[model samples]
Target chain A: MRTEDFLRDITAIRGLSGDEGPVADFVADAFRPYCDEVWVDQMHNVIARKKGGGPKVMFAAHLDEIGLMVVNIEEDGSLRLGQVGGVDPRILPGQRVWVYGKDRLLGIIGAKAPHLLSAEERSKNYQREDLYVDLGLPPQRVREQVQIGDQVQLEHRYTALQNGRVAVKTSDDRACVAMMFEALKQLQNLRHEADLYFVATAQEEVGTRGAITSAFALDPDFAVALDVCHADTPGAPAWRTHKLDSLVASMGPFIHPVLRGKLVEVAKEQNISLQTAVVPRSTFTDADGIGEARAGVPTVLLELPLKNMHTTVETLDSKNLREGGRLLAQFAVAVNEGWEDELWT
Target chain B: MLRDTLQTLLGAYGPTGQEHLVADKVRELLSGHVDSMRTDALGNLIVEKFGAEENAKTIMISAHMDHIGLVVTDIEKEGFLRVHAVGGISPRLVAARKVVFADGTPGIVALEPNTKGKKEPEMSDLFVDIGADSREEAEKLVSIGDVAVYAPDFTALGRHKVASPAMDNRCACALLVELLMYAEGQKNTIVGVFSTQEEVGLRGARVAAYAVEPDIGLALDVTAWGDTPQTKLPAVKLGAGPAVKIMDRSMIASPYVRDKLFEAAQAAGVAVQREVLAFGGTDGGAIQLSRGGVPTGTLSIPCRYVHSANEVIDLRDMEGALKVLLQFIELA
Candidate 1:
């Protein structure tokens, strides 16, 4: 499959926020063929560097996904869950989950039957504390196979929807990761003077930790952070969402206004659809961390708009992913040694 | 004697991005005492005092020269200068306080009164009144992006204590200057970096450490005091000597370097506090994480009301810290 089309495969692999070894290995392999060098940091940040003699430009996209962890195991072989990132408990009823225990096991999220619930309890929404994961095994077997801290991924069923839209788990980020891979693929044919570092960062959901260290180590002169933004979904606040088809570029105090304008310029020149996100404060993305790295890097956040963000079914229009890659690749070409001087002007 | 040096440094007008004045002051003090001195791209003044021993390792000692300030974001039509914090300065702390621009032009910070009862005003609601009657007159005094810090006013608090606006870091800069002047026949190549933009995010030290690439690093800064009532968690006190940091939000102290600080304190016969700051960080956090990670620690002068107009520190703590740093260069 084309690298841009591999978002489903990338999202299928489990890589929770601080435990991204599996995701790192796959991302490193994908990046190995396209860049000068690829290496994984202690934080599992996959950094693929393309050496040049000009200013360094870092392109970052997080690889970690939202999930739950086994917080407790009852005597009846049921597991209690705590969120690893922002797992909405609203979608957890009777869903199949992948329990990454001593052995890979399948389990079902169980709740009280509606027929047996009291009216007071039934009137209210199901709280996460009211749910448990039932593994089909004896309590002793559960004790042997599972531990309290083992990662549990919510059920994911990748679906190809009508009009080239696709739904999959963890696409809030992995789609952007795949989009970076596509950018790397495109940069092969482009001419650029800047040293480019394509990084699949880890632990962004927790607090942009990977970007913090990676940006510090690389000390890039400029950076662009790619992540998914909430696309237009029905019943969602219209002012807060973007079209599912257009790529997003955010401007705020943390984001370099000039660098963001440069992305828009590139998008316009390349005939790619781009939208502006006027974030007043923190972008709450990797850009927030990368821009503050060292004496401060001129960093901008470019986003792919997806529907149903932070859910198991993050839906995206596949063409925009490829469009975002092309735009970023062209942006890499647009950045020269003089771009730093342009930022202040 | 160190209080005199701090008084001299506080005279210089320097904010986060504008630290050259402080660097110039530091260079003037340490000119003939050090082997070499230079400034980096970000205006960090790195001074070297060569060791008199064979095969000595390089130990980078950094004290940030930058202090908190507010920058002009826009000028309102009514001649008021709209501002935002360049560092971590709060609107509540700066309200109705006198501020000085880099060029010695002074202004007063004022908050707009709103009918929104009892709610704290934001930086947007705050403006600087430079006594300018018109926008044209305000433009003549300060331009957009020009920064202004709290007007410097050194106050002696009782004895062995002094309170000042930029004392959070100018005191540490004074201490480092004292170390460079007095640290003689040391076993390590002492690279004293009067770093810049530390209040912004340890930016100067991050790149400075990468360029210096020292075997060991230490940040001289001030830590918050818990001796004041209702401030109980940090467990540090004023006049209790300099604190050896355990950890802060930025980087955890390397255990080897942290323990060596205690040993140096013991050797110097100076009392020291153990600082565990729940918030705030220093340049040591950047130096420790630089290029394969050099072992680093911080020596903090315990100060009350840090990042305020009246940051207070004890002179005895500076004297004690100077003694310990002289021992640390050889032992660490």
Candidate 2:
């Protein structure tokens, strides 16, 4: 698949963490053709196994996306949104969104008008309870249309800018799903010893939940996590974000130190540009849960640097997405040859 | 044997991080019985007995060794020790109770006792009295950084129930040890984990479950019994045998596991009852969500006065629980 085509397919998948069945189905359909078999576990984690004659190597990418769940439907037709993952309220207001109600109800995150606000009121941090999503419909119509526990995401167009950067919704991790699919297609005919488990995990945004259960079931010699990372952008926190040229790997809280080093070595051998995502505590990825699942499976988190994370305009380079995929495939092939000795030693 | 084991374990002055004494005692007891054993990074006791089949799927059975205690946060001029409860402690049950430090020094938790028509004092309003005149004298015996727990004292109660400070979970730990003794040359592999910090967010179980990644996990812990006068009748009671946890706030017991446990109970002719806890969570929640997930369940011994100094349980329930568990693992 072309890089843009892969990116497009990922952006097309609409999975919001806790509700990941649909995206898992989509991932299974694409993954089944390239592997021997595909199955999903209870956590809605999709596992596609490409069997070889040696030890197993499992690679995981979360299929879930961070968005909003409708906690309550207010009487005035406005929707109260509860964060499925972490949603900054500062960025939520005034943004256009698609509320996946009983029907496709279009809405906007409404903020109190600045004209009506006192200077002191404007200075205070706004709580999610103080705001609601406004659909341009009467209360009765909205009541018939939307319901509690509906999913919502920012409805944004996937656009390509002049410098090959693309922007869209749910790109934080759907981008990784696309990359894994393309990588599997590329590795279909390769002669390898280790059984390759390509898993698209679920509920990762809420917690590294699916990965914990899925990784334990697989019990591979090694694991590689393909997900999204923070890319340097204008007004982005300088310390947290990194340059796009470098391949970003998760650092603390989750990444197994040896596994992280091995992936870094693979990136170096392939001459792939690399960077480090210093997650001092937890990386809000599948790695945190997967690392400690079933005794202790060594895990490495590989990230595709993206800009405007959790926003409608989540942007990334099409080339970077493909690079992330290639890096994962290379890491797998390296493991297929011999990675266990190093892992154990 | 169970009572002696409990006495040895409880008598050892070990609280949370200073569990070396208890671990050493456990190692001595299980030395020749298990095939291999090792202490993990987080201070959990991992004892393993291999199955007949090579590389048979691993099963981890966890029981925590940690107990609730006090950490001295501050020491006043008059030698009163201000403490923070390390794990869950009822402020009402704490006042005037005797305590033992890790060094075996004895003291009393001196707090304002609740009187008629008076509310119980919170933990902050309480202090530990070690009978020292000055802070300088108290420092010689127990330092401000020291930790202590309610002193060990086991008493046989009505109808086979035994009450003790750490019986809330130490009963489960005893059962695991008993299972190990009876599990000689078992067909399937068993990883016995005497986990740490179960009283605090099931932290040790979380790590141990993730590491072992069993096809199935069964947490052996104590559950609340409402058999007493203050509690509702026909609820979990002492001597009701092992309570098969059907559901708890933390996890929904997988049907596969629930059936297995039921079958084991029926086949062994052991008394069994269903338990659906309204509140509180267990290591089952941690194991249920462990990699991709495992079919997780729990077997809880019914205990009265949980999270208190003197948790009470019937030894008959422990025996019944062991029978069901051994039968389950024999065919597992």
Candidate 3:
């Protein structure tokens, strides 16, 4: 199946951190057709395994999404909200949201009319607190149904932009999860011998908690942490952003150098355009956590360049996401028995 | 009974780190109802109500006992006292508010005059006056590190709603205490933790979760309301019913546990709202991420003006939450 197909299916779901059950199930089902065994942990980490005599390898990307949470309810039936993850309040006003209350109700975040605002209020942007959701329900019915603390999801609007680009909610890490699916689809035929475990980790948005636990549970000989990187966006600093045409293999203290070198070599061998991201400290992905699991696992961090990092329209280049799959699949095949000993050398 | 229990707990003098007095009151109420009870290192009152079935899940329900207060930082020579907020006390809200120390010493919080009109004031712009002549006289009744909370002023608002300080959690405490007293032959072991220092942080619940390592966790607390005037969003109303927390700053409610709460509401034939709080946290946050992890959700009593004097809640919501908890313990 196409990566966009998986993205289409996954983006519409509302699975925030610590509440990724359905997303985990979807991932497990997605991997079931491509692997030998699959199971979801209590923490909702979907682990799909393929046994082999070669080195044990793990590929992971978080499956959770960022959204706003209901903080209060207005008597007139409006809903107050807070950020679930790094939800940009600047992008909130006039945006449509899915209120996951008694029902997955359609809600709109309204901006106060310019006529209603004073000159002082007009000069400033609305803070997150200034925004409230209007579910368009009666006040009494709203009280009967909606609860405080229900998640307000970013409405899933998949826009296929020019030049093989797709914008979808949760494309940040879920795009990488789809990339893992792409790798799995390719690995069905082009396998060497690595015992592969593809994990769609939970709660990565909440400080990489799932990666820490899942890595400890899987204990792979080699791990490849795949996630999205900031593609060049308007007003974003050039130093921190990458292009959308290629996949990025990050090199830093957290990433294993030899393993990264091996990934770069595989990308070169596979003729996939690969870029390098120099993260001086924490990669801020599963790479930091998986690298230190049980006397250290040789780990590599792969990045798919995406635009609009935390906004509803998280854009990504389909070509780069597909290239990431090929690179990861080739890396799994390239990780032979001597790969572990070569880390020190 | 929930109202009376809440009123009693609200009357107890317990600040963030000083919840032993509240715990004492809780013990007195629950002494005979629970199977076992103990105080943890953090002064959390942990009590268990056993189930009839064997191999049942260890479900922990937590309601914090501590209230937000002002700690005496320094005393002025003229007897006005300098203070720092212990929790989420807004200087603007506390100005001209009445407070009382644990020893029944009453005082009034006063805000310094702002030279610029329409300028926002801060804690530094505020002070406490205890009708004292000098620093020594003020020190005789109050000391440094002594906490002063909103003096108890419980008033019934209209019919269903009631107003007071510390109703943020005392309402939940009442819900838990009543659940323990009401539930019989439940299928799961219910451990009620009257946790300490939650207003400061989830300090008491953190250690309590480590000790209990429960199979599931639930936090009972008050959530903010948007029904009153300009406070838009959060969609929760006081008189409607209790709320089921979806996510908060401290945690994303575990789906299995949160969904079961919904089912429990259905089973109990009670009303419940889905909650998504942006600010503050409950003990469930600590319990959800404890050790490996525990499936956890929060049941919130819809409260207004939380952390301020005259915090308001509806008894109907408390009743709905108690009904849900009674059904929840049996199902979970």
Candidate 4:
């Protein structure tokens, strides 16, 4: 599948943290042709492995996306919201959502209208409890269709921006999953020594659950978790964010230094546009969990610079995704050619 | 006997992101009972008890070995240590509490006196005093990044309850170890994972569950109780047997697994309470969400004053958990 198509298809599917079946199945099907063996693990992590003799390299991208869950149904047929991961309440008011229940139903996150709100209430940050999803049905019918604990995802259409950037609801991670698949496609003809495993992990937004398990199961010599990091915008801190057009290679306590160094080297050798970010403690990615896997797996994070993370309109440069894919493919090939000797040393 | 084991495990120092010593102690205790054992990348001690049937389903019983503690971030000029939380150590709990470093260095955690009348002191206002006169002396005893757990005397309360530090988890670890010794002839291939860094973010259980790849996963951990005055929610009380977890902040217990636990408890004639924690998560949270998802639930030993230095648990609750776990493994 093309990167754009893969992103579009997967992002359209609702894969909230604990509930990620539809998207997992979609990713598994996309991985089947490029991999020697493709299967979904007990956690719904799609593991596609290309068998080889040398060190094992696992590439992970989470399939789960941040959204809302129905915590309660009000008497007025509106649904009370509980976050699936970390759904920002500020962006939720008036946003459209697809409530996954007995059937997918359109709903709008409703809050008190600005005109009716007092100055104090208008100025204060909105809490998740203040927002409710208006499913436009009677209380009895809404209760019948949308039960408590049903998943709700933002309704977004994938659209290309003016300068090669794309906006979607779940670009925080679905873009990375697309890039990993693209990287796998790029490596299909290459004679790499490492056994490459492409894992589409689950429930990363809640916690890096899929990476934790899949890394232990694969027991790869080294792994790279691909995700999207915040991109520099007008008001955001420049030092902490990357440009949307460039790939971000994370360096931190959670990341293995040797793995980070090798990725930097590979990016430079391959002429991939890269930026570096230092995460002192938790990278808040699958890399954190994968790096600390039993005995420890040497792991690094490859981040595609994303704008407006965890919002309905997450934007990212398509070129950065392609570059990240290329970088991952080169890194896998480099590891295949004895990157372990340098890593161990 | 259970009290002795709990005392030893609770007395051990195994902070999040650093649980080797705890794993070592657990490995030593479990070595004789299990057929094979190994520690995984995240320092999860996975020990397997073989079943008589070759194709029996694999069941993973997990308990975190690590606990909430303080990590020294810096040493001040006056020999006081600036520390950060290794897990979710509340500022209120750390103040005026005795703590011990890995090498048995004793210290008192104290908050800077509130001159400005702040309602609650932040963690930054707290420091560990080891009675050292200078930074050199403090450095000689504790290094940067060294972890220290609360030092509390384990005391038996009445006949059935015991109070100690880290009963949130060490009680569960001891329970798993006891199960390994007593739960004979399991039908399933039982993997006991004494996980690490669970207090941090369920780190060890995530990977450990993946490594074990069990058909069923169960976490033996402590749950909060509402026996105290002014308690309203969670309705669980100490001495109410083991609580079968229904949901928490991390993941909801799988209904099938929760039902199966209820069935096992019923079959074994063990009284069990239902747990619906308002906050906090156990290893089962990560295990249930492990690859594609495992049928996972938690057998919670109800405890009072969790995450504090003087956490208390009932011995009968521990026994109830073991009974249900043994029955679940055989019956599932």
Native contact fraction per model: 0.02, 0.37, 0.54, 0.15
How do the residues A44-71 of candidate 4 rate in per-residue lDDT, one tens digit apiece? 7889998888888889999988887776
lDDT of each: 0.88, 0.78, 0.87, 0.85
* Model 4 C-alpha lDDT per residue in residues B24-141, reported as the tens digit of each score: 8887777678899898888899899988788898889999998899999999999999999989899898899999988899999988989878898888899999999999999999
Cα-based lDDT at residue B164, candidate 1: 91
Candidate 2 lDDT over A1-345, as tens digits, reads 564776676666667765576778877887787889999776678999988777777788888777775655667777877666767777878888888877776788997888888999899877765778999899999878875446787665778786778888778777888888767876765556677898888767756777877887788777778788888888877988888655688788567887788888888998888887788887667777667766677788888888888877888887777787788777777764566667657
Off by over 4 Å in 4: A72-78, A115-118, A136-148, A252-270, A334-336, B1-54, B58-116, B121-215, B220-278, B285-295, B299-331
- Please identify which of the two predictions, 1 or 3, would achieve the higher TM-score against the true structure: 3
| Clashes in predicted model 3 | 24
Best by DockQ: 3
- Displacement of the residue A122 alpha carbon in candidate 4, Å: 2.2
True-structure lDDT of candidate 2: 0.78
Per residue, candidate 1 scores C-alpha lDDT tens digits across B1-332 of 68789899988999998899999899899888999999999999999999888889899999999999999999988899999999899998999999999889999999888766757779988999999988998999999999999999999999889889999799999999999999888888999999999988999999999999998999999998878877654667899889998666675566578889999999999999877565789999888767645778999999998888999999999999999999999997
DockQ of each: 0.04, 0.17, 0.32, 0.15
For all predicted structures, in order, the TM-scores are 0.56, 0.60, 0.81, 0.68
Candidate order, lDDT descending: 1, 3, 4, 2
Model 2 CA deviation exceeding 4 Å by range:
A1-3, A72-77, A98-104, A135-150, A235-239, A249-271, A276-284, A293-295, A342-345, B1-79, B88-199, B203-284, B291-332
**What is the lDDT, from 0 to 100, of the residue B174 in candidate 4?**
93
Every model's Cα RMSD, please? 10.7, 10.0, 4.9, 7.3
